[model samples]
Target: MSGEQLNEVRKVIWLTGASSGIGRSLALGLAAEGHQVIASARSDVELAVLETLSSNITALPCDITDASGLSFLRARLSHLSSHLDQIILCAGNCEYLDFPEPDWDMVTRVMEVNYFGAVNCVKTALPLLRQSAAERPHIVAVASMVTDAPFPRAEAYGASKAAMRYFFDCLRLDLRSEHIDVSVVNPGFVDTPLTQKNNFPMPFLLSAEDASRRIIENLESRPKNYSFPKRLLCLLAVSKILPALWQKIVLNGADGKARQDVLNEKVGE
Candidate 1:
C-alpha cells in the first residue's frame, strides 16, 4: 500500500474557509482521497458549488466569527456526522494598516477572522473531536509566515497570525494528555484571490494547488508547527540574527516605498 493510503483511515474532517483559495483546494484534495469533508464558509453559494464536486464533501456554511451562532453551527455539524476525526481551521482574512492615516479598526477585524474565528471552531468541535475513535485526533490551523518578520503596513495581519501561532502552541500542550494533536501551518506567499491584489514581489510564491499539495503531504506527520517554503523561512531568519540589517531592508529610503509595497501587496498574509 502507498504511504498515503496507509495513513488514510477515512477521517471525518471539518474544514473552514471552504469557499476559495487554500480551503477550497484542501476540501477537494481530502475528498478526492475518500475522506468525508464537512466544508464550511460564509459564502453559502460557493460552498454549494464545492459540495457538487465530490460526494465526500458536505457544505456547512457558517460565519466563524459569529460567537452566538456557533451553537446552531454545532447542531448542524452534529446532524452531518457523529464525530469529527479532524478539523482544518482554514477560515481567515487579511487587512493592512497603511501608512499615515491607517485604519486602526483593521487590527480588530483581522483578529476576528484569523484568530478568534479559529478559536471558535475549536470551541465548537472539542466535544465532537473527543468522541472520535482515532488514536489521536488532529486539530490544524492555517496561519501565515508573515509573523516571522515585521513588515510595514502588515501590523494587523502579522499580529493576528502571531496570536494564532501561540494559541495553537499552547493548545497542543494541553491536549497532549488526551492524545489529541494540534498543528499550526505557516505558509509563505501563495497565489490566491487574497494575494491577487498584492502589488509587491512575492519571493518563492507557490500556486494554491502546489501549496495545498505540500500541506496535505506534510500534515500526516502532525508536527506541532510546519512553515514553508524553506527558502522564505530562511530569508525571514535574517530579521532575528541581524536586526540592524533587517531594519535597513524594511526602513530604507525616506519614503520607505519598498516596505509599503510589500505590506499592501501581501495583505492576504
Candidate 2:
C-alpha cells in the first residue's frame, strides 16, 4: 500500500521504551498524525511528559522485565477503545564486555532487557494486535545495525539485537497467514542518552527526532528490514562481505587499544 493510504487508516499503536530517545519522538510524531498512541516505559515521569506533549497519547508505565507489571499493562490495554494496530518494541539496554574475563552476567543483563524484554512485551501485545480489523497487524522491533558486524566491545549488545532480529524474522513467517507484518529496524549510531556514554567516535550519528521520523516514514511500507543512515549500513555491509579486509583495515591494534582504554575508564568510574 502507498504511504498516503496507510496514513489514512489511523492505527492504535503500542510503543514501548517511550520515556526517551526514538520512542519518545515516535510517540509524539504518531500522536500528531492522529493515531492513538499508547506509550510504555519504566519512567512514569517521562511518560507523563510525553502525554502532555500530545492529546493522542496515553502514558502506560511498567518495567518490561517484570511479568506481573506486564500483566497490569495488558489489563490497562484492555480498557482502550480499539485493539492495537501496531506494536513497536523499543525497550532495550546496551552493555559492553569489558576486560579481564568476559562478564557473562553483563551479557545476561543486556539479553534480559534487549531480547527478553521485547519478548515479554510481545507476549502481552500480540493478542491486542490480533484484534485489529486492518489488513495487516504490524510488529516493529528496534534492533541495531551493530548486529551486521562484530564490534570489539559490543559482544552482548550486538548478540542480543541479532537474536531479536532473528526472532522477529521467524515470527514474520509464522504470522504471514494471519497478515501480521513484522519489521526489524536496524538503526545505526543514534544520538540518544544511551549512546552518549560512548567514548569513541560514532559515524553517521543521527538525532533521536530524525531517527524517529525515518522510522515512521519507513514503517508505512512495512518492509521486512529498515536500516539507516545509508553510509553506516553500507560500511557494515562491506565489513560483512569482506571480513578479512575489515579486520586488517577497519579494526587494527589501535582499535583494540582504544576499546581497552574505554574498558579501563569504565572500571575506574
Candidate 3:
C-alpha cells in the first residue's frame, strides 16, 4: 500500500505511558493526523497538559500496576467509545543492576512496571481492540533495543523488555486468527526525561520527536518488529554475531562508572 493510503486510515487509539518521552510525542503526532487518541499515564497533570496540546487527545490517567485501576480504565474507555483500533503499551520502568550487589527488589520493581504493567493493559484493552470490526486491530509495544543484546548494568531493564518482546511475539501467533496485528517497537536511545538521568553517553541517540516519527511511520506498515537507527541496530547485530570480541573490546569499555554505580546501589539496597 502507498504511504498516502496509510496516512488516510484513521481510527481510535489508546496510548499508555503518554505522559512523556516517545509516548507523549506519539500521542501528539497521531492526534495531529486526525486520529482519536486516548492518552494514559500515572501522572494526571502531564496527561492534562498533553490533552491541551492536541484537540484529538483525551486524558485517561491510571497506574498500570494497579489491576483494579485497569478495570476502571476499561470502564472509562467503554464510556469514550465501544471500540479501539490500536492500543500502544508504552508504560515501563528501567533499573540497572550493578556488579558487586544485585538488588532483587529493583529487578522486581522494573519487572512489575515494564512487564506486568504491559500485560495488565493488554488484558484490559483486549475487549476494546476486539470491537474494531473494519480495521484490523493493532497492539504496539514499546520495548527497548537493549534487548537485542546484553548491555552492562542493564540486567533488570533489558530482561523486562526481553520478556515483553517474548510476550507480544507469542500474542501475535495467538491473535492471528482474530485478525489482531502486533508490532514490537525496539528503539535505540531517545532523549527523554528517563534517559536524562543517565550519567553515561548514549551513542546515536535520536530526539524524542525523531523517535516518535519513526515509530508512527513504521506503525503504518504494521511490521511485526520495528527497530531504529540503522547504525545502532547494526552495531548490536555485529556484537551478537561476535560475542567474544564485543565483550572484550566494545561492551566492557562503554561506561565504567555507571556500571560501578549500579553495583553500589544494589549493594546498598
Q: All models: lDDT? A: 0.88, 0.84, 0.85
> lDDT order of candidates, best first?
1, 3, 2
Q: What stretches of model 2 exceed 4 Å from their correct place? A: 1-9, 253-269
For model 2, residues 1-269, the per-residue Cα lDDT tens digits are 12233334479888999998888888988989998888999899999888888877888788898866777778787776347899999988988888777787999899988999999989999888888878999999999999888787888999999999999999999999989999999999999989998876576679999999999999999999999987777666656787875565445456645544433343343
| lDDT preference between candidates 2 and 3, better one | 3
lDDT string, candidate 3, 53-92, tens digits: 8777888889899977777889888877677889999887
Name model 1 segments beyond 4 Å from true.
1-9, 253-269
lDDT string, candidate 1, 1-269, tens digits: 22233234489899998999999999999999888888999999999999889878889899999999988888888888778899999999987778799998889999999999999999999998998989999999999999999877899999999999999999999999999999999999998889888766577789988999999999999988999998788878878998777777677755535765553343333
Please estimate how well model 2 matches the true structure, expressed as its whole-model Cα lDDT: 0.84
Residues forming the 10-long window of minimal summed lDDT in candidate 1:
1-10
Ranking 1 against 2 by TM-score, winner: 1
| Candidate number achieving the greatest TM-score relative to the actual structure | 1
Scored against the true structure, residue 26 in model 2 reaches a CA lDDT of 89
Candidate 1 to truth, TM: 0.91
In order of listing, the candidates' clash counts read 1, 0, 3
With a 3 Å backbone cut-off (N, CA, C), the pairs that clash in candidate 2 are none
